[model samples]
Target: MPCVKIDMIKGVRSPDEIKHLAEVVQEVFLDKFAAPNRDRYQVITQHEPYELIFEDTGLNIPRTEKLVFIQIFQQGRSADQKRALYASLAERLEKDCGVPGSDLVISCNRNEKEDWSFGYGRAQFLEGDL
Candidate 1:
């Protein structure tokens, strides 16, 4: 399963756009990680323009434009898979959402089975939820 959270400037996209983004992410997970149809995936998107800030803390500088941050979590995905996935993701995002690849920053992290509790504090996948 791959859970993704996208944070971007507020008023940047409509609901359809947001759903398209989620679909794109899901497609990437399915194609790259070989996630099954029964796999549970969740994606939460937050749009905050006024309060959202992009800065270079190391250089003590503020970024002039908005940025898209995508955080994806998968249970068992290889580094090579991630690398290839991001490339395809960026291209698709640019083509579908008009978000340039340069503006997209994706973070891929590993999640162990013990870390997720789907329901009732259970780690196993529920039938209906899947």
Candidate 2:
């Protein structure tokens, strides 16, 4: 399972836009990351204008209030898969959510299967419940 965390400035997008953004993300994960169907997990956090900060990091990529930061926590994805996921996310977010590639940032983190526990204080992956 891949758990995605989306961070963006508040009031920049409408409620329907947010839902659509999440859906687009899920679609990219399914297509590029090979995440299973019905296994989507995401958290969207809206920060106040002053609460979030994003710099170009010398990349000369101008940023705006529409900046979106995404973090993906997942298990053992190949480098090619990660690259495809990033490219697809940028493309689809731009085409579908109006999020420009320069305004988007993404980080993927790898973890072991034991790192997750779906519920009941049990390691579902280890317990064979996953």
Q: Could you tell me every candidate's TM-score relative to the true structure?
A: 0.80, 0.98
Best-fitting candidate, scored by lDDT: 2
Q: Return the top candidate by TM-score.
A: 2
Model 1's TM-score against the true structure: 0.80
* lDDT (tens digit, per residue) of candidate 2 on 1-130: 8999999999999999999999999999999888899999999999998888888889999888999999999998999999999999999999999999999999999999899988889999998887
Off by over 4 Å in 1: 55-66, 125-130
- Report lDDT (Cα) of residue 51, candidate 2: 88
| Model 2 global lDDT (CA atoms, 0 to 1) | 0.94
lDDT of 1 by residue, 26-127 (tens): 777778888876674665556556665555557644343336778888777878899989998888888877777667778888877667777786666443
Q: What C-alpha lDDT, on a 0 to 100 scale, does residue 18 get in candidate 1?
A: 78
Alpha-carbon error at 25 in model 2, in Å? Answer: 0.1
Clashing pairs in 1: 10-49
RMSD of 2: 0.7
